[model samples]
Target: MFEDAFKLKIRPDGLEKAAARTYVTAVRDVLEKIHRTACGKALLQSIRFHGYVVNIIPYPGADVCGADVDGDYDAATGIVMPTVRYTPGNFAKGGSCSHLPGRGWAESILFHELVHALRDIAQGKRRVYKGVVMTGGLHRYDTFEEFIAVLCEDIYVSERGNPHRLLGDHRGIAPLDPALADSFRFFATGSQTFRFVERFCRENPGFTKMLSRVPARFNPIAAYYKDPRKAQSFSNSPAAHERDADGVWGKLFERERSPTLPTGSPANLPPPRPASTPIRRP
Candidate 1:
C-alpha cells in the first residue's frame, strides 16, 4: 500500500492478502480514470483526499456494491466499496463496465460514490455560488443528489459528449423515468460536471433547502450541510424534493403524467445551454 500514490486509505478490513491486494489495485485504477481529464480533476479537488477511507465490506442486503457516508457537514468521512464480486449487477473481479471510457466495475462504482462525496461538499455552508453562501440546505436524495450523481456518472463516461442516454447504454441512463429525460437532457448534455452542478443551483433555484432548516444555522462557519437520513438519503419525497415554482426540476416534475418512456435522443432537440460563468469556492 505504501507504494500506491492514491492518498486515501483502502482498508481491506478482514480480507486475506490476495483480496486486499485487489482492493488496493482497484484504488489505483479508479484514480487513473478520474484524473483522465480536467473536469475529473475538479471532482477530485472538490472532495479533498485527506482523511478519506475506503472500506472493503459487502452491502449485500442493501443491494449496493458501494456507498458513501455524509460528513459531519462539508465532506463525507469515508466510502464503502465492496471487494466481493456483485455478479447480479455485472460487477465482477477484473470486469469492466460496458460504458464509455470503459473501465472496471470497481472504477465505475467508486466514481459514483465519489460524486456523492462531492455533493456533500457542494452543500457546505461557506460555499458561495454567484455571491450568496450555499448554507443550511440539503440537496437530499433521489431527486436532487442522485440526479447530479447519475448525470455525473454518465458525463464521466462521455467525458465531453452529451450525457443523454444513447442506444445500448442502458446500465446508467436507461433507468431514469420519462419525465426526467428532459431534466437529464437539459442539465447533463450541456456542461461538464462542475458547471452542471453550479448551473443546477442557479437553474433550479430553491432545490437546496434553507440554511435555517439544517444544522448549519447553529455554527454557520466551518459547518457544511449534512444528511441524517442514513442509507435512505436517496428518498425522493415531496418535502425533500419540493418542486419550486420557477425551478428547473419543478418544471421537470410537472410532466409526471407521462408514463414510463424509453430512453433515446431525438434527432432534433434543444442545443446545449451556453456555458455558465466559471465557478469557484470562497
Candidate 2:
C-alpha cells in the first residue's frame, strides 16, 4: 500500500524536515480522532483529497503562492494534483501550527488547502481510484451538488463552533461562514436545498448523535450539515406536517437552503420557508 504513496519530491532541509514530519504526525493523530467521530460520507470526501500534497520543496527563487493544479472530480484514481508553496518568510508563523520555532505547521497551512481539495473534488478535479486501476473522469456539478456542499460547510462549522480553536487568533484567516457562503454563491445558484438536512442535524437528537459517527477523513465542516435523513421529503405535498416541529420543520418547510435577492425575513415567509440559515449550537 505504501508503494503507491506519492514520494515527496522536495524534502525539507535540516530542521524543516523534522518540523514538517511532526506536523504530518499531528495531523494523522487528528485524523484518527475524527475517524472515531465524523460522519461516514466525510470519508468519501477525504478519499478524494488524500495523497495529493507535494510539500516542503525548496523555494523556486520566486514568490508565487501555492495553488491547486488539478481541475474537476474523477471517478478513478483518488489523487488530485495540487502544488502548495511558501516563500521562507511569507507563511503562518506560530501557535499549535507554527514554523518559527521550527515546528511543522502543515495542519494549519493545509487546513485551507483541504478546503480547496473539497472544491476540487466536488468540481470534478479529483480522479477516483480502485486498487491499481486508474481511469480519468470528470463530473461537472449541477446546482444541486453545489448547494449541498455549501450547506454542509455551514452546518459543519456552526456545530463545531470552535472558530478560535481552529482560527488561532489570526486576523488574516477568513471567517469560515462567509467563506462558505461565498463558495455557494460562486459555484451554485444559492438555492434552498439543504435547509432540511441542516435543521435536522441541528435539532434532532438522533441525527446530532450520528454526526460523531462521521468518518474522520471527511470534512467535519461539510458532514455536519448533510444529514442523510433530509433526503426524505413528503410526496406531492406543499404543506407537509412535521412530526417534531423544531427537528423536522426546516426540511419540510424549506426544500432549498439558498438565500434570495430580495431577502425576506424568516417570520414573513409562510410554509416551505423562502429563506433559512444553519442551526445555532446554543
Candidate 3:
C-alpha cells in the first residue's frame, strides 16, 4: 500500500533515476507520517489528485517551473491529475525544490489538486470550475479558495519550519499567513472580513438582497472571514458610534483588533512552493 501510495514511475530525460527515487521516497515519507494520525486527512485527500503525469521539458529561454494541476476530474478514476514538470539545466541537478531534485512544488501542486477533488466530492459538479488541475492552473482559485490554501500553507509552515523544505512561505504575499499561525492571523483576518460584510449587509440589506436569490455563491463561509467595519459602505452612525465608545460590541470590535481565539492542531501545513519563494528547505 505504501509503495503504491508513493510511487513515481514517470521518467524524464536528463533526470537521474536515483534522484527521482529519492524524491518519491520523500513524498511517501511525508504522506506516511501524516496518515498515521488524525492529521493525515488533508495529506490523504491530496493523493487522489494523482492523475496524468508530464515532464518539464526545458527550453533555453524558459524560466524555472514546477507541476500544475488541471482541474479536470477523472470521472472514471475519481482522481485529479497534475502535470509535474522540471526545468532543464544545472538547476535540475541541484535537487532544490525549484530544481529537479526538489519536490517542494510537486507536493503543493498535488495538495492543491486534491483540494479540487475534495471540493468535487463535497459539493458535487455544482461547484466545479475549470483549468485548476493542469500545470500553472492551481493559481487560478477563487478568492475564498485562495484564502483557504494560503491559510493552510501558513499553518503548515509555522508547525514544520524545517530547513530543508521549500513550501508554505505565504507571509510576504498576505498580511496573515494562510497557514494557522500562533497568533491565528489568518483566522483573525477572515473573521474580521466576515463580520464587516455581515454587518454591512444588515445595514443596507437591499444592496445585496439579490445575493440571497441565489444560495451557492453568497455563502456564509465567505462572510465568515471578513471584518464588519471594513464593508465597502459601512459608516459609523450615532448609535454605532455610541456602541463603539461603550464597547458594547466588544467581541466584534476586538476581532478587528487582535481578537483572542482558540488554537488549531499543530500538524496543519500549507501546500509546498518553489524554492524561488521565501521558504526554508527542510
Candidate 4:
C-alpha cells in the first residue's frame, strides 16, 4: 500500500536510471521485510497514518553521514531530509575503520532512516509499542530517539543474519550485544513484550557521544559525552552547577521505558547555513 512510502528524487544530474531503480527496489524490499513482523507492521502503520509519505532522496554530499532525517517535518512529505547521504562503506573519517557495506546494505540503511522518519514525525505525539510508550518527541535532549532507532535497526539486522548494521558507535561491535539482542529475540518469536526502556537505558548505547556531538545551538543538549557528574543547565549552560539532578542529566533521561511517564518529540535556523540539521546519520 505504501509503494510510495519513500519517493526517490534524484537532485543531481547525469545519474543513470539503473542506479535509481536499484535504490528504489532495495528500500522497498527493506520495508517489505519489516512489515512481515508484528512490531514492524505497527511501526509502518504509525508513519502511514501520520500524514507523511516520507520523502527519501539519495543524498550526494561530501559529509561522511550515511543518511540523516531532520527538518520541520512536513506532514505530506514526511520528514524532509535535504542531506540523506545514503552510501556504502564508512563515511571516510568514520569513528573507526570498517569494511564498506555492499548494495544490499543500502536496504538495511534505509531501514535505519525509516526509524528516524518515524521518530521525527511522532514528535508532540504518543504511541505505545510493545507496551512501552514511545513518547517520541518529549525529551529535552531527544535521547530516546537514537536509542530506539539503533535498537530497531539492530533488530532488523538480526533478521538479515546479524551483520554489522548498527547506528555508528555500535556498528561492527557485533554479535549484537546480548542485552540489545534480547528485545529482538522476543519480536523474532512473535512477541513484542520488550522492556524497552529498562534494557535500553541500562545499556546507554553511547547516547552521550551522540548528544555531545550536537551543535551548541541545539539547546537542552549536554556538553560532554564522557561523564554526567558535570551539570550543565538544560536551558542555560552557564548555570549548570547551580542546578540539581534534573538540571544535569542524572536519571530524568531514563523516562523512555516509563509507560506512566509523560512525553512529547529538530528543526531549522536562519543564517549562512540554514539547512536542517540531521539526527546523526553515523
Point out the higher-scoring one by TM-score: 1 or 2: 1
Error of 3 at 116 (Å): 4.5
Residue 206: error of model 2 in Å? 20
Point out where model 2 deviates above 4 Å. Answer: 1-16, 39-41, 44-80, 83-93, 96-112, 118-151, 161-282
Better of 3 and 4 by TM-score: 4
Q: Alpha-carbon error at 51 in model 1, in Å?
A: 7.5
Query: Residue by residue across 40-104, what tens digits does model 4's lDDT show?
Result: 55455556666554555555554444466644533554444322345433322342222344223
TM-score of every prediction relative to native: 0.44, 0.33, 0.40, 0.45
Name the 10 consecutive residues with the lowest summed lDDT in model 2.
Answer: 133-142
**Deviation in Å, model 1, residue 81 alpha carbon:** 15
Best by lDDT: 4
- The RMSD of every model to the true structure, in order and in angstroms, is 14.7, 14.0, 14.9, 15.3
Point out where model 1 deviates above 4 Å. 1-7, 49-90, 93-105, 122-141, 160-282
Off by over 4 Å in 4: 5-22, 36-39, 63-65, 73-104, 124-142, 160-181, 184-282
What are the per-residue Cα lDDT tens digits for candidate 3 across 64-144? 333222344557755443333323222233433343333333334344433333433333323334322111111112243
Q: Relative to the unseen true structure, what is the C-alpha lDDT of residue 20 in candidate 4, on a scale of 0 to 100? A: 65
Clashes of 4: 5
lDDT of 4: 0.40
